[model samples]
Target: MYGYIKGVVKKVYPSHVIVENNGIGYLIISPNPYEYKLDDEAIFYTYLHVREDVFSLYGFKSEKILNLFLKLISVSGIGPKSALGIVAFDDTDRIVQAIELGDVKYLTKFPGVGTKSAQQIILDLKGKLIDDEVEIKLISDAGKDVEAALVSLGYNKADIKRVMKHINVDQSADQALKEALAYLLK
Candidate 1:
């Protein structure tokens, strides 16, 4: 339910930061946790995540990053940890680029993400991100139109989907489709 947290940094650790708002302390996990400083006032765009067994706060340096994290988590098979890993070393542009280019190798470099999980991320989030502040260029003209074309040409959607899952956002739709098709045929 919380949106953002503005407070003084009480303590900074290698993986988490403690922010003091009023008299309470919030332990926030961040991709680059050490980017914050102790005693410095800062604003963290936060997401309060609660499950059956745990409650935690995940913070981001910018609203764009926070929104990206939320979008990543919405994907099926993607959890908060996976989303955090995607955004930890990669930014919004990098993710979009990975999807557009169908770069499974690059995406798999992130912690906890494997070939299947990476494909799932593309299936769920491809062309679904809201373009507000982040400038994500659509590499495809018709948004998965190429995949549809491949399907119409007798290829199975599931196979095409699997192929497209590795593409990055920086590559054009035509490029991704061609690459995905090649991967599938190989």
Candidate 2:
């Protein structure tokens, strides 16, 4: 039960990082491995997943992400990998609010989460998440749909996010799309 590890980063893969401590290198999977650089010192909160065939260690940049990952894996259909995906969703407060509010549509935006799994997430974790009161300004179903549409039309999500800051109040997915594109092109 490795609760945490502090070491110098040896190598960083897209999905994992190798940290060296006490003459040994430990490979730890992280949601965003690029956050840790080679030869940099870091303390990663960790969880060890044990199974019949394999054992793996997952590291998180923060306790909130680690806790969220644990909660995600507790769901019936979610494994550690899927849970990691959910944790990688980038906004812990928004995700917790979505689950607390039973927003399946929002959950589906996470990688590896489908409709059935989204609903299962709502059923299994509703009211169990920490209510962090993060102003979830526009992560609604409509907002996510619009974002997806923009991505399909060749806009990157990060660029869309920058443009979205100029969008006005909530609108239907279609209306949001038009407004978003208008702002983006400007």
- The sequence of per-residue lDDT tens digits that candidate 2 reaches over residues 16-53 is 99999899899999998988888999989999999999
Candidate 2 stretches with Cα past 4 Å from truth are 131-186
- Write one digit per residue (lDDT tens) for candidate 1, span 44-103: 999999999999899998998998899888878889988898898967787877765566
TM-score of each: 0.71, 0.70
Each candidate: RMSD to true structure?
A: 7.8, 11.4
Compared to the true structure, candidate 2 yields what TM-score? 0.70
Candidate number of the best lDDT: 2
TM-score of 1: 0.71
Error in Å for residue 109 of model 2: 1.1
* Candidate 2 Cα deviation (angstroms), residue 24: 1.3
**C-alpha lDDT of candidate 1 relative to the true structure:** 0.78
Error in Å for residue 36 of model 1? 0.5
- In angstroms, give how far residue 140 of model 1 lies from its true place: 10
